[model samples]
Target: MKKTIIISLLSAAMMTSCFTTGDPRDGGIFWSPSKADARIGQLNQTNNEAMHQKQKAENRNKRLKAEKVRELNTY
Candidate 1:
């Protein structure tokens, strides 16, 4: 019985060690530094893309508002 308990504890520890703690994108305990760095780079790229899209939207809105103002001034 004692041996079975020890085996169970060891198995649980090994399984938990493989589990990632923070972001799901993060590599768990077994992953190398380069893999984690790559994940971080991907996240940064995604964020930059989102910011670019936001800026485009804002510029479009500003252009539309300027057109509306110009139309009103003509009338």
Candidate 2:
């Protein structure tokens, strides 16, 4: 009814922002390797899903590949 619609509009208006992340009070997110050694931060805080996933997958693959190559060489 009209009352329900008015309440819904007021609720939407009260909201501050749509997006939120990484609560500081909960111990700042510990991103390892720092941005210096990792050479990645812009992409880390980006709003793109595919880019983030691809970067993460690539990093894992690279580490595994390096580990395998090292093991083979040591054998």
Candidate 3:
């Protein structure tokens, strides 16, 4: 009986130690902040890159339009 009680206590401790606390999708409670922050940073970087590309395209279009106007004036 004593041995059984000791084994039970040890098993319970092991189970609780490995138990998750929060939502699994959010990376639970232990590593939530690091994982969430990394995901957010990745999304922000992707958005910034997309915005940079769009700005470059717009600038190119404007420059092309100005060149076309100059050509027309010369003609």
lDDT of 3 by residue, 1-75 (tens): 999999999988886776343345644435555666677788899999999999999999999999999999998
Ranking by TM-score: 1, 3, 2
Regions more than 4 Å wrong, model 2: 1-47
Better of 2 and 3 by lDDT: 3
Tens digit per residue, CA lDDT, model 1, 1-75: 999999999998888778543344555655456666777888899999999999999999999999999999999
Tens digit of per-residue lDDT, candidate 2, span 1-75: 999999999878665434333433434334334533343455456647778899999999999999999999998
Worst 10-residue lDDT window, candidate 1: 19-28
Model 2: residue 46 alpha-carbon error in angstroms: 10
Q: Judge candidate 1 at residue 31 and give its lDDT.
A: 48
lDDT, candidates in the order shown:
0.81, 0.65, 0.79
Instruction: Give Cα distance to truth, residue 46, candidate 1, Å.
Output: 0.3
Q: How far off is model 3, as Cα RMSD?
A: 5.0
What TM-score would every model get versus the actual structure? 0.60, 0.37, 0.56
Top candidate when judged by lDDT against the true structure: 1
Instruction: Give per-model CA RMSD.
Output: 4.9, 14.1, 5.0
